[model samples]
Structures are given as C-alpha cells and as structure tokens.
Target: MDPNIQGGSYDNPSQAACAHGHYGVAKLLLERGADPFSQGGRFTNALQAALFSESEAIVKLLLEKGVDPNPGNTLQVVAYYGFEAIVTLLLDDGADLNIQDKTHRNALHEAAMQGSEAIVNLLLERGTDPNIQGGAFGSALQAATYHNREAIVKLLLEKGADPNFQDVQGGLFGNALQAAALRGSGSIVKLLLEKGVDPNVQGGRYGNAITAAACNNCWWDDGREVVTRLLLDYGAILSDAP
Candidate 1:
C-alpha cells in the first residue's frame, strides 16, 4: 500500500498517524515515502498535526525527518497551548519566536491570551519583545489585560511592555486600559492606571476607556459599573466618552 495514500479525515496516512500520536505508524509511513510536507488537513501538515496531538516524540521524529520548525505558527501554537517542552525543542531547532501568525500575533501574544505564564516567562527570558504590537488586542499587555491574566500582564509590564502602547494598525481595544474596560476587568484596569496608562488614549472601537467600560454589558451586573468607577477615578475624560 502506498504510504502517502489519502484516507479518513486526514490528507494522508502520515498525517492521520501523526494526528493520532501513532509514532510507530508515522515512522513507518515516513520510511515508506509519506511526504511529511504533504499539506491539506485541518492542521495543514503532519508536523502541525503532531503538535495538535501534543506528541513530543512524533514532533521530534518529524523534525528529524526534515520538517521546518519555523513555519505555520509553530512556536505560537505551542506557546498558546503551554507545551513548554515542545516550545523549547522548537526554539532549539530554530523556530522564530517573533514570527507572527495570520492574526499578526507572536508567541508572546498567544501565551498572554492563554494565561500561559511559564510560556510567557520563557518567551520573555529568551528575548521575545513584550511590545511587538499588531494582533487583535494590539499588544501582549492588552491581550493579557483583556483576558484578565494579571500575572502575565504584570510580567509584560515589568519587561517593558508599554501600558499606553496602541497598535499603529489600530485594534479593537486600542490600548491596554481600554482592553481591561471592555473585558470588565476592573482590577486589570486599575493596574494599568496605576502603571500610568493614559485613560483617555483613544483609538479603539469604543474610543476611550470610560466608553469601553460603559459599553461592557457583561453577565455580572457590577462588572461594568466597577470598571467604570475605576476608569473615572483614574480621570477618564467624560468628553472623550465614545
């Protein structure tokens, strides 16, 4: 039987084996000429499938078989999933930590969004800039604040993430303060404010921090109210509202 034969929900036997963490089967397929680079499945390739399967052995096998560790947001995906060992392997094999996905987010952004503190720390310690803005949240700080990842937020700030930094491309939350407001994360909002983030720095969908808080209709009745008060206390300009 041809090892590259496409079947099941995978593009090829190799992909299926890798996706299911069948290391032995994947090895056999590769040995029989299954192209590790064959692209088509939901994961785009066998190496990515192995990543989804969270199988380090299969990942190492594919890498040894000539899979490019730098492609397909490899580092970002592992960082997002908190696969610390896999992340280390990819980095060691030359995966670019600063490589942004289609959404323009680097590994730091993914780690921040997923609250993966260890990954975040690793990326930071490895020299991943905490403020390479462009993603949906503009910056890692905004992403962390939006997701209420307090520890990650603080970490990024300490590492030189600009609290007032807005993505030059313009994003949904504009700045970290506005992001916290939209998330109804009063504590994060306060943290940013205490860090000296300008509460009136407008640009996002809601324009400013107060407006973002006002527009937050979360399930918790006091969520928006709490954030609004925090924004106000920090001197969010009412004239800049919306």
Candidate 2:
C-alpha cells in the first residue's frame, strides 16, 4: 500500500490516525514515509491533528519527523483550547509567538479569551506582548475584559497591558474600557478606570465607552447602571458616545 495514499473521512490516513489519537498507527505510518506535512481533514496537517487529539507523543513524533509546529497558526488554536502542555511543546520547539491568524489574533489573545490563566501567564513570561491589537476583542486585556475573565484581566494589567490601548484594526468595542462596559463588568470597568484608561477614546462599533455601556445586555439592569456610572465617574464623555 502506498504510504501517502489519500482517502477516507480525514483525506489522509496519517491525519486520521493522529486526529483519532491512534498513536501506534501514526508512528507506523510515519516510519513507512507517510508525509507528515500532508494537509487535509479538520486540522491543517498531521501535527495539528495530533494537537486536536491532545496526544503529546504523536505531536513529538510529527515534530521529530520535521513537521512545522506553527502551520495554520497552530499556536493560536492550541491557546484557544487552553492546551498548556501542547503550547509548551510548540514554544519549546521555537514556534513563532507573534504569528496571528486571519483575525490578527496571536496566541496570547486566544489564551485571554479562553480564560486560560496558566496559558496567559506562560505566554507573558515567554515575552508575548499583552497589548497586541486586532482580533474580535482588540488586545488581550480587552478580550479578558469583554469575556469577564476578571483574574486574567488583572493579570494582563499587572503584566503591563496598556489600559487605554485601542485596536487600530477597529474591534467591536474599541478598547478594554468599552468592552468591559458593554459586558456590564463593573469590576473590570472599575479596574480599568483605576488604571487611568481614557473612557472616551473613540473608534469601535459603539464609538466610545459610554455607548458600549448603553448597549449592555448583561441580564442585570443594576450591573449596566453600575458600569455606566463607573464610566461617567471616570470622565467618560456622554457627548462622545455615538
């Protein structure tokens, strides 16, 4: 049988084996010269398939076979799922931390959005920039804030994340302040305010923090009012809201 013969639900045998965590089969196929870099299936390649399976052994086998760990922004995907072990493996293999996907989101942004504190800490300790802009939530701080990951939000702020930083790519909430306001995260909004975030820094779907607060649907009217009041107290300009 040709080792590289492509077929089946996964488009390739090696990818199927890796995706299903059939470690022994994946090893056998690789030893028989199956192309580890063959792209298909739900994942981009065998290495990514291994990641989906959470099989560190198969990941190591693919890496040893010289598969690109960073293929298809693999680091970002791993961070999104909060796979700390695999993330460490990729980083130790020298995967590019700065690589962003179509949304311009790096691994750190995914980690923050997923509320993966350990992964966020790991990325930060390894020099991942907290203030990288773009993606659905702008910066990692904004992602954490919007998702109501208070601990991650505090951690990002402690790691020197810029409170007033706005995404040049024009994210939905513009900045962390706006994101927190829209989510009705009063604690997070207060934290950002204390950090000196400019409540009126414009340029997002809602234009400014006050508008985002006005659009809050956090299921708690009091929470929205709290966030709105917090924004106002922090010098949010009502006239700046669109």
lDDT per residue as tens, model 1, 61-172? 9889878998878888898899999998888787887998887878888899999999999888888888887678888888898888999998999998988897677677
Best by TM-score: 2
Q: Compute the lDDT for candidate 2.
A: 0.85
Clashes in candidate 1: how many?
0
Give the whole-model CA lDDT for all candidates, comma-separated: 0.85, 0.85
Return the lDDT, model 2, position 90: 91
Over 51-112, each residue of candidate 2 has an lDDT whose tens digit, in order, gives 87999889888888787878877999899999899899899888998798876889999999
Candidate 1 regions exceeding 4 Å error are 216-220
Q: Candidate 2 — which pairs collide?
A: none
Tell me the lDDT of model 2 at 193: 83
